[model samples]
Target: MFFTPFFKMLLHKKYILYLRVFTSLVINRTFIPMTRRFLWLLTCCIVLLSACDKRMVTADNPPETNNPTTGAPPISDKKVQAGVQGIVTDANNDPLAGARVVCGDQNTITDQYGAFRFQEVNMTEAAAVVTVQKAGYFNGIRTFRVTAPGRDQFVQVQLLPKTTAGTFDATAGGVVAASNAQFIFVPNQVLDAANKPYKGQATLSYAFINPESNDFADIMPGDLRAVNDKNELVALQSFGMMALELQGATGEKLHPDGTNSVTFRMVIPATLRKTAPAVIPLWHFNESTGLWEQEGSAEKMGDSYVGTVKHFSFWNCDAQFPMVNFKAVFKDDKNNPLAYTAIQLTRNNNSSSYGYTDEAGEVSGLVPANEQVTISVKDQCGKIIFSKNAGPWSTDANAGTFNVSIDPDARLALSGKVTTCDGAAVTKGLVNIQVNGVHYETAIQNGNYATSILRCATGAATVVLNPIDETADKMSTSTFQLAPGNYTRDLQACDVIQVSTISLLLEGQTTTFTSPADSVLFTSYRSDTSTVSIYSLSAAQKTPGGLIRINIQLSGIQTGPSVSRYFTVAMNDGTYFSESLNITITRTGIAGEYLEGTFSGNVQKIPGNTTAPVSGSFKVRIE
Candidate 1:
C-alpha cells in the first residue's frame, strides 16, 4: 500500500501500450476498456516486483565474482586458508613461555618470546575459539575470525591471575631472620575433584644449621615458582638441601582426591648444575629418624626440575651431592708433585671448586663427590694444561688423595687486553670464547683477559672470541688458529655512548632528546672484490626519554673516496618522515678507527605542508 502511488505513476505513463498488447492477445485491441486494462496490468506488476524482493543476501553466503580467464560461472562459496599468531603474557606483560594454546584440533606451546602460530588453518571451518592455558594464570579463551587465505590474524592474550596464592616471603615466613628475599605466587584458581577451590596450606621446614654464610643470597627470586603441565602452581624453598613441605588440612592430598599428585619445581643455578632435566628423587624428612627418605623423583624442565608428590611432607631434593675435601698434587711425567698449579674440580652435579697447589705441590679444598670426577690443571694464561677423569670417590674418611701428571709440551696460553676507543680500560666487559664446541666465559679484569694453560688439540683447533655485556655493541670479533705457546694480543674495543644528546631546532621551538645510545651495531659483508661496512644506531624507545633513531650505510673502506652513503632518521612520534637530503662524511676509518659525520634533512610532516629541519652529528668507532 505504501508503494501504490509509485505504481500509479508508472502505470499512468505506459498504460496505453500495455493495454493494447493485452487486448491484442484477447479478441481485439479496442475491446477492453482502458481503465480495466490498466488495473489488470498494475496487479501483475506488483506481484512480479514482490517476488524479486524475496531474494536476500547475507555474510555467510556472499555474492560471487565471475572468473574471467575461463569464463566460468561465479562460485558463491570457496574454501580459504589462513593462519593465527598470538602472544601469551602475564598480567604484567611479561612473556609466558610453555603456555599451551589450542585452536580447534591444532595446538602449540608458546616459545620463549611468548609467541605461537597455527599455520594453514582452514577458514571454512567454524569460527575458532582459541584457548590459552598456563599454570599460575587463569585460562584465556577468545573467539577470533580467520582472515582470507594467505592472511594472518594476530592477537595478544593476557592471562590474568585467578587469585593470589600469597608470597613466599622469606622475612615474614620466618625462613631466615630479617631476610630481604621475597617471592610471590599468583596461582590460577582450579577446581578439585569435589568441584571445590583447590586452595591448600603450606609449611616450610629447614635444617637449623646454615651451610652458607648468607642464606638469603644463595637463592634468587625467580627460582621459587614453577608451573606444571596441568597449569598448577608449585612453590619452592631451597637452600643447601633445605626442605619445603606443602600439605592440606588433616590428611588431604595437595592436589585433588582423584588427581594423582601435586607438583613443584626448583631452578638450579647453571654454575652448580651439570645437565638440565636430570631426574632427582624427592625426599621427605623423617622427624623421628632424623634422616631423609625418598618419596618420588622430579623431572627436569630446561634449567628447573618438576617433582610430583603423592602426599605432602617435609620434601627435599635427594640429589645425593656429596661435599668432600680433595688433596690433589700435580706433576710432570717424573715422580714429583708439581707446585703452583691451579687444580679445577668438576663434579657430576656440575658444581665446580678450585684451589692452587702450595710450594709442596699439595692443594686441598672441598669438592662434590660423584661416580666420576673431572680434574683440570692450568697455568697463568687461562687454558687447560691438564684434564682427565679420575675414578670414583674413595670410601675412606679423608675423602681422596689425587696424584695427577701433566705433559710438559701440552701447555698453551692466550692473553688479550680489552680497551675502549679512547684507550680507556673496559674493566666490566666480558668475553666469551668457543673452542671446538666447548664454551668458556671469562670476565675482563683491569681491562685484561687471559686463559689458563690448555692441552694440545688433536687436529686443527678454531678459537673465537665474542665481546659481550658492557662492550657488546662495540668490539670486533677476534678469531685465532693456534698450535701451542704463549701469545698476547691487544684488542681495541668498540665504545658505546650510554647517553646521547640530540636536538631539533625549528619553527622557533627547540626539542631535545636524550637516550642511552644502544643502537650502534656495526657489521660488514665481504666478497672477492667488494667489502662494505654498515653501522646502525638508534635511541632506546618507549622510555622516560623520547625516541630518536638513525641508520647509516657506507661503502668503500680505506680508499678515502666519497663513498656512497644512505641514512634514515626517526623522531619522537615514531614517524620516519625525515628523508636524507644531504649528508657530510668528514672522517672515516676501519678497525679501531672512528667514523665522524653530520646529517641534515627536512621532515615532511604532510603533503605541501610545513617541513621541519633536523640535523645531528656522531663519532663512533668502526667495527
Candidate 2:
C-alpha cells in the first residue's frame, strides 16, 4: 500500500490514458481489432473509477446519442395535436355507413351511425382537408379546423344523388346538308331507371371539331336559344367534339321519359363536302370505359346532321366512312310496281336504314353496313309487304339491286260500334283493342269507333271497352276473328249478365218488375226497333250487415236498342260500391233522346268488376 510518489503518479497517469483511449474507441468506428482486448480492459477500469468519481451531467448539456444500425434521421414530434369527428349523410339526412373519411394522413371509416373520429391527429395547417366518399353518392369535401384536443371539432356533410341533367333530341326528318360535316342533337326520351320522367334541370352540349383538331382544347358551352317551349341550340360552327356538363341536377334524376327532349342544330359549312364526303357518324364518350361508342347514324338535314339522345354527356361526330347507295324495287302480287313505299334495311341489333320508293317503284339511298342485315318493304299504312334477310353486308360491296312482290290483299280494316247487350253505345269510355298481345287505345265517340290492326289468320282477336267514369258496372270484353277485308260489327261490352231470355220484337214495349226481397222498382226503356227493355234500377238494401245504395243517370235520344244498368247485389241483401266503375249507354236518333246500352263493371263490396250478368231496357215518352 505504501509506495513512492513517483511510482504512484506513474500509475495514475496510465489509468487516465487508458480511460481516454476507451472512451474515444467507443465513440468512433475507426478502432482496429489489434487493440480490442486492451480496450475491453480499459472500459472495465473506467466504470469502477466513474462510480468513485460520482460524476453527473446537467439537462442543459446532455450526452450525444445515435442509432447504431440504420443510420436514419431522427423522427420529429408535432408541435400541435388535434382531433376531428363528423357524420356523413345524404340530402335527406339519412346516415351513410361505411363512408371513408380522410384528413391529412389519418383516415377512419364511418360507423353504422355514420360517425367518424380521428384520435391524436397531428395538425399540419390551420385547416384540414377532409374528404368523405361513398358509393352511389357524390364525393364531399370540407376544409375543417380543429381548435381543441379530443371531441371538439364536429362536421355534418350532406351528399346529393347523381342523375341525368339534360337530354339530346335528334330531329325525325332532318334537312339534307351539302357540306362535309354536320352536327345535330335530337332529344329522345329522358327517364329514370324506372322509366319515370326526369324532373330536374340538366345541361346538354356538343363539341364540333375537324378530325384533325386538338382534342385537348376545351370548348365553352354555347348560348341556348328557345324554340317554342323546347331547349334548342343552332350550331355556331361546322365541327368539333363537345363535352356536356350538368350543374344543380343532382337528386332523383337518372332516366327520363319521352316527354323530355331538346333539338340541337348544326350547320354544315360548304367546305364539309371536301373534308368529309361520307356520312357523319354519331359518337358518345364513355366515361367508364374511356372510349367512344357509336350510338346511331344521323339523318341529313339541310346543311346539318341530326340525331337524338336521351341523356346529357360528351357527344361528337368526327369518325366517318364512305356512303354506298343501295337500290330496291317493290311490286305487288301481279308484278305491278308500287309507288311511295317505305323500304327498311335492318341490322342484327335492329339498327335501321329507311328509304321511300318513287313512282318507278324504286328506292335508292346510301345505307350503312352491319354484319347481319335484312331488307323489308312496307306500304303507306306501315304494314310490312315484303321481308328478306340481307345479312352479312360489306361496306365495300354496298351497292345491290333486288325485286320483291307482296300480296295486296294482306291487310284489313276493322270498324265496329261498342254497345251494351241491349244495343246502347258506350260514349264516355275508351276502347282497348288488342291483336296478338299488342294494345291500341281509342276514345269512344258517338257510340261509334274504329281502329286498325294487322290481320291475323289464326287465333281470336279481342276488343275491350273500359269506361272512364265513376260507376259500379264492369268492363265489357268481346272476342272474334277476321279475314283480310273491311267489315262492321256491333260489340257488346259488359259484365256477366243473368236474366230471363225473352226476345221482344216490337216497339212501344214496356217491362217493369219489383224485387220481392228488396221492394226496388226496375223500369225498362224500349226502342221501336227491338224488344229489349233498358231498365233503371236503384235500391238501398240491408244485407251482409250494412246498408248499400246504388244510382244510375242517363238523358238522351237513341237510334239503336238500349239496356239499363242493374244494381245487382252479389251477396244476399248487400251491394258492392266503387267510385271508378261505370255502365255502358248508346243513343241514336234526333237529339239522341232514345236510350239503349249494356252494363258491366260493378263494384260489388269487393270493389272491382263483377261477373254477374244483368240487362234491361227503358223508353222515355217524347213530350
Candidate 3:
C-alpha cells in the first residue's frame, strides 16, 4: 500500500512547478470585460478554463467523534467554547452562498461575502462538508475534520463554470433557431447525491406552427407531461427543470454553435408555484394597440388593459397595464380564428365545462364545480390537445382563464443596479433575485434594467449578479426586504479572486515537495482515528471544483527500496472527528508532476457543533 511520507515527498516537488507555469501565461486571473453582443457570441462559441462537476451529498447518520464531547454543549464542566467567523471564497475569490454549512443537522448560507459564523463552536466537533450551488456554475461538496476547541478557520471554494467533457455526442443536445431567436438547454448528465443515476420518467410535447401565420413566437418548445416511473400527466407549470424552455426568440441561453442538441438541468418548483396558474390571470394580445388585454376584466373597446391578479391589477395600474384588450387575427380553414394559447387556472373535480370560440378563436367557461374538472383547448385539427384530465399538449398549453381576486399582499415593487468596484454603472450584468425563493431575474437594460417583482419575508431576498464576460466565475450578492410598495438599493459584486495566482519568475522554476502555497486550502480534516491534511495533490482534496496549481519544493529524499506511488489524503468525516493530519499522499505524473483537485466546504463544524456555522471553503485547481 502507498504510504504518506513517500507521497508527501513527491507532491512537494509538483506544486512548485504549477505556479511557475500559470503565472507566465496571464497577467492576472481577471478577464477583460466584453460587450453583450460579443459576450453572447463568445458563450455561443466556447467557454474557457472549465473543470467543473455537479456532485450532491446528503448526510443522515452523523459520524462518530473521538472527542469526549464532540457534540456536547460547552456549558459542561470541562469543555471550553469559542466563536468563529470568516469568508468563503472560490479559488477566483468569489463568495459562495447556499454552500451547506452543517454542524450535525444545523446549516446556514454564506452572506454576500461568503461570510459565516458559528456563535460558539466547540473545538471537539470538527468534521464538515461544504456544498456549493449557484445557477450556471458547477456544484461542489467537500468534507473536512475539526482539531481543537474554540478556533476560527479560513476557507476557499474554487469553482469552475458548468462545462462538458469535449464536444457533445450528436444525441447529447444543441441549440435550435426559430424565426428571429435561438434557445438551448442544460446538459442532462445529472447524478444524485449518492452519485447514482437518477431514474425518473419525463414527458414533453408541443405543436409546430407556421411563422408566416403570426402564431405564438413561430416555433415553441413543449412542456413536461409527467416524470418518474409514473406516467401521470403533470401540469407543464409543475415541471421544475422540466418547465418548458419558453420564448424561442428570447430564451435565456446564448444559443450554442451548431443545431444538434441541448441540455437542461433544473427542477420545477410546483410546490412553490401552487397558486401561480392563469386561473386568475387571463390576458388578451391586442394587435391594434400593441398590448395584452384582459377578457372579462374590462369592456370590449372601453379599456385596452390586461389585469394581473398576483401583480398590479390593470384597474389599479394607472397606465402600466390595461384593464381590457383585443384578440383574433389568424384565420383557420373554416374562417374561424386559430392561434396558440394556454391557461393558468385550477379545475375542480366533479364538474363539466364548455364554451364557444370568441372572435379570437378562443373559448372559456367555468368547469362544473366538481372534485376534479377538465378544462381544455381545441388544437388545429379540432382534436383535444388532451383533456385537462387527459394530457399536456406539445409546444405549449397555458393554464385556463383567471377569475379570482388577488389579496393585497401579493404584489410588490423592487429596483436595483449592476455596478463595478468603483461604483460606475454597468449595463451588461445580469441580476437574479430570489424572494421566499421565488426568482425574478433582469438585466441593467440597453443602458440599465430593474423591475418590481414581488418577494416575501426572507426579510430581504438575495441578489445575485453575473458578469457579461463569459469566463469570470465572479458573482455578486446582497440581501434586502420589501413590503407592498417600492424599495430601492444598490447591489455589489462579491465574487473574489479565489485563486488569483501568478508565477513570479521564468521557465524551469518547478520543483518537488508540496509547499503551503501549493496547498491553497489551509484546512484540517477529520477521520475516525485522526485528522488528515488534504492537498490539491491528495485524494482528500480532489473535488469537481476548479484546481489551483500548487507548487512544492524538494526538501530532500532517500534513494532505493521506495517505490513511486500516487495516493491522496482525504477528510473522512463519515465516522468521526479528529483534527490534524492522518496524512495520506500520492505520487502522480509520468515524469514527476502532480495535479489532483480541491472542493467546497465549511470550517466552523470541523472545530465543534457548539459553534454556529463557520464561513470558509477550499478551492482545488491545476494550471
lDDT of 3 by residue, 136-189 (tens): 343333222222343332223333334322222112223332221223322332
Q: Return the TM-score for candidate 2, rounded to 2 decimals.
A: 0.22
The clash numbers for all candidates, in the given order, read 12, 89, 120
Task: Residues 1-623, candidate 1: write the lDDT tens digits.
Answer: 99778657546533444334433442232433465445433443443234223322223323233111232111112445555665566745556666777764345556454666654344332234466777644455443323234444444565654342232221111111112111111121222334344444432222211222222211111112222222222322233233332223442423212122333434454343444336765655433222244455665444444454433334555344444334555555433344435566655544444444443345554445445778877643335666788747543123334545444345445567888777777768776554432334456788888653334544345666765437445655577776555568677666443334334444445544443424343333322222332333332232334444444455543333343355454555645544544556677664445665655667565434567776665555543
C-alpha lDDT values of all predictions: 0.45, 0.40, 0.28
For lDDT, candidate 2 versus 3, the one ahead is: 2
Candidate that scores best on lDDT = 1
Q: After superposition, how far is residue 199 of candidate 1 from its true place, in Å?
A: 58
Q: At residue 587, give the lDDT of candidate 3.
A: 24
TM-score of each: 0.28, 0.22, 0.23
Query: Compared with the true structure, what per-residue lDDT tens digits does model 2 show for residues 237-296?
Result: 123344433332453334323222223334444455344424565554433222234444
Error of 3 at 221 (Å): 28
TM-score of 1: 0.28
**True lDDT of residue 166, candidate 1:** 30
Evaluated with TM-score, which candidate comes out highest? 1
| Residue 611 lDDT, candidate 3, scale 0-100 | 24
Off by over 4 Å in 2: 1-282, 285-410, 454-474, 481-484, 496-623
Over 4 Å off in model 3, which ranges? 1-408, 421-424, 432-441, 451-477, 492-623
For lDDT, candidate 1 versus 2, the one ahead is 1
